[model samples]
Target: MAQGAALGCLTIASLVVARWGGPAVLGEYALLRVLPWLTGVIASAGLPVASTFFLAARTGSDPRLRPTLLTLALAGSAVGLLAWAVAVPLLHRLFFPDLSPGLLLLAGLTVATQLFTVWGKACCQGQADMLGANIVIVGEELLFLPAYWLVSHAGLHGITAVVVAMVGGGAAATALSVGRLAATGFFTGRAAPSLRLAREVVVFGARAQLGNLLWLVNLRLDFLILDALAGPAVLGIYAVASKFAELMRLPATAANYVLYPRFARAERVDTDAEVRRLLPRALALTALATPVLALAATIALPLLYGQAFRGAVLPACVLLVGLAVEGASAVASAYLWGIGRPGANSFAMGLGVVVTVALDLVLIPHHGAMGAAASSSAAYLATSAVLVGLTYRFSSTGRVSTVVASRAEPL
Candidate 1:
């Protein structure tokens, strides 16, 4: 519930920004986000998933692992900062030529703060503190909306205000997350993390990181592709449409927050019955919600964004189809990761990225925003099919064995 409300607020906040600043500003904000978000995902090195899996498994026996995981994440953030420095100039020249050095520096800060936020949320998730985890997830947008509104009202418009608001919100959220962890005694006690455990985490994190990086690429690479081929104006329109499409994902996001921990614990017991039971209902709900959301968005988008964004309607609807497929796929992917099959998950995402890139290259130049939408939706459908098949194959044999054992037992 908290996660849903927070995500809803985020959607509203984004709409507010769009209404206040229009397409160019919204497009620039979306473009500026690409590098930092991508860099932060890379910098985290899959520690979020690694931490959740390892920590959930070990939290009962090794409380000290929290600080160790955090220490490793902090080191990863420093490395991520260095990466941002190298990537920023190239990214700026290619996508954000008008951005000033100061704005770029602020973008770097966003990446650093986001790393901290990711680490903190990972810790809460590892501990199975759902409330704390949701807070961390939602905190930034809560802060960002108010800051954005204040700045815009105070006559600061365009990318400058958006970047400042982003940085401020990120800093605030990171602090709150860290504070929540400290308050819960995550950083307390004298027992230190072991070298063996550290090595295990690093090894797991490396594998998980690759999968995560690929997954992010599948999600965000479209922005860059669109910007290069269609320019900012078209990209901005598509970005707005994409945001509405993303709302279709809220149910899946909420489900995964609770499901990942449950899946992790279930993996320990070698039982997937719980996951199997819950997945269909989650997917059904998401499937049912998508068209309703599409209807609402069709009506609301024009009102919220004005007629300048009327073109976003069809694209948003198309992307919602993909998001709906992605909702179910997300649950399956989480199950795969929880069961320590990130390699398989990565392969699925890689296949999807290939599909997306192939289609985007052919389609974006000719069809523009609609082509981008079609490419993303097709890729999502293909990837979802692969993941669903992989997940069922992996879990079905165990399920059959369990069923046979139960049937054969004396009753």
Candidate 2:
């Protein structure tokens, strides 16, 4: 429900942007965000995944684990802020075109605050405090919405408005998450981060982060390409379509929220059974939801974004199957990560990335957003197919049907 609400908030904000500024402005907003977002991905170093995994794996045996996560988040965010500042001179023009380099500072601060929420949620997941995790999501989205409202109503436009509002939301959300963490005794002990622990997180996190970074690129590479080849106005239209397509992902995203910590605590040997039980459910939900989401998007695109954005309808519909498959791919990726084989996950996403780049390059010139959607869908299908194959190979029974038949229960 919290995740749903967060998506709802995002949709509302997008609507406001589309209704107020049109696709060109929205496109600019999207492009402006990529820099800090990419930086955060690198700076995070997979700590969100690693912190949850290690903390849960410890089974509360290590009193210092909680504080160590805090330390890691702090150090990571600081590094990210510095990197974002440094990269401004070189990258702003290439990616953002005419935008000022100074805006990256605001973007960096927003992402830094977001890192705290990310770590806080990871810590909660490690502790199985699902409520806390949900609160973190809720607080950020809800707070950001009003900030965005204020900025928009004030007649602020473009990168400055979007990022300033993001900073407002992020800072407030960080305070909420940090206070929650402290109140819950997550910072109870004075556990300074040790080199051994840092190394452990780094070794494990680097592998997971590689897959994460690849997945991130696979997901967003088209946005950059679209911005470059088609320009921001076209990219803006595509962004709406992509956002609508994200509905198919909710089930898998929610599943991973619970599954990662649960899987991390289990032994690798029987992780296959866990996958069998959960993977089918996740895929089923994604499949069932996709067409419904497609239908809603078809109806809502014109209603919410006006006739100009009706073009997004086709592109969004095109993304459903691909995004559904991508949803399943994510669940499978979580399984691999939980079992300490993030390297395998990287292999699958890397192939998808190659496909994404090639097809996007080939398609975007002629067909624009439609071509990009088709390419994205194909790449997602490819990624999921390979990932599913990996899942089957890793499972001892070698066949999904065989395993289901071996059990008396229905999948």
Candidate 3:
């Protein structure tokens, strides 16, 4: 519920930004956020998810585990920072042609802070502290609302002000999250970094990171494509529309938050049975709720965003359908990850990315937001189909084995 409320606040804050700044400004803000987010994801090196697996499995108690994870996290951040430094100039030229280099540099700081914040939250999540984990997740956005208001009210406007506010909020959230982790005694262990542990973490994190990276790409690449093919105004409208569609997935998102750890623990027993039992219920609930959400969005979005955003309606509806499909996929993905099948998750998302990119390339130039919507929906459906099949196969085999084992045992 806390996570859900936080997501709601975020949606409201985004609406406030759109209303205050207008579409072009909103478009620029959306564009600016992409790089920092992508950078943070890359820098995480999939360790966040790996942390959840390891910590849930109680590996954090290992004297060497925590320090090794910390070292790897720092190393990943350094690599991301270096990559950002090299990419900024080209990115500025390509995306934000009018923004100053100083502002872009500030955005880099936001990325750095975000990486640390994600690491902190992952630590909390691994301990099965959802409240603490969510506080970190939501705190940044909560702080951003106030920070954005202050910055905008100070007579600063446009991308510069937006980026500055983001940096401030990110810094505060990172600090708070670190403090929270420390307070929880997450760092109290007598751990020292070890080469062997680090290598294991890297190997595990690499597979997870690759899957996470591909997933991020699948989610965010459309923004880049849209911005390149269409202008800020169009991208802005689509961004808002898509955000509305994204709300439909909040239940799934929250479910996965709790489910990942649960599934991770269940893996020690029989994950296939757990997946079979949990996934269908999640999918059914999501499937039932999505049309209602779509209806509400269709009526409410135009009213909230004004007719200037009416263009977003169809795409939003399209995306709602897609997100419904994604809800099922998310549950399956969590099960896969919980069972230590990062490679399979990565393969599924990679296929989705391929579909998304191909469709976006073929359709966005002519159809714009609608084309992007179609591509995303199709990709999600395809990914969900593949994952569902895999989960079913595994779960069915597990069920059969359990029955056979039961029958063979002396009565």
The top-ranked prediction according to lDDT is 3
Model 3, position 252: C-alpha lDDT score? 81
How high is each candidate's TM-score?
A: 0.92, 0.92, 0.93
Colliding residue pairs in candidate 1: none
**Number of the top candidate by TM-score?**
3
lDDT of 3 by residue, 1-411 (tens): 666777776777678778887887788888666777678666766777777777776455576777787787788778878888888899888888777777787788877787888888888888878778888888966888888889988988877778888888888988988888888877777767888767666666778778788777777778889988897889889998888888777888877777777776663347676777888788887788888988888798889989999999999888877778766787888877776667778888889889998999998999999999999888888888888877676568643323222110110
* Per-residue lDDT of candidate 1, residues 1-411 (tens digit): 676677777777767767777776777788666667667767766676778777665343575676678777777788888888877778688888878866777678888787788778887887888788888878856888877877777888788889888888888988998998898888888877667666767767767777677666667677788888778888888988888888877777777766766676664335466656666776788788888988988898888878998999999999888878766787887877676667778888888889988998899889999999888988888888898888777777554322222110111
Shift in Å, residue 102, candidate 1: 2.7
Candidate 2, position 12, lDDT: 85
What value of lDDT does candidate 3 attain over all alpha carbons?
0.78
List pairs with backbone clashes in candidate 3: none
Lowest-lDDT window of 10 residues in candidate 1? 402-411
lDDT of each: 0.76, 0.77, 0.78
Off by over 4 Å in 2: 32-34, 153-155, 397-411
Model 2 residue 229 CA deviation in Å: 1.4
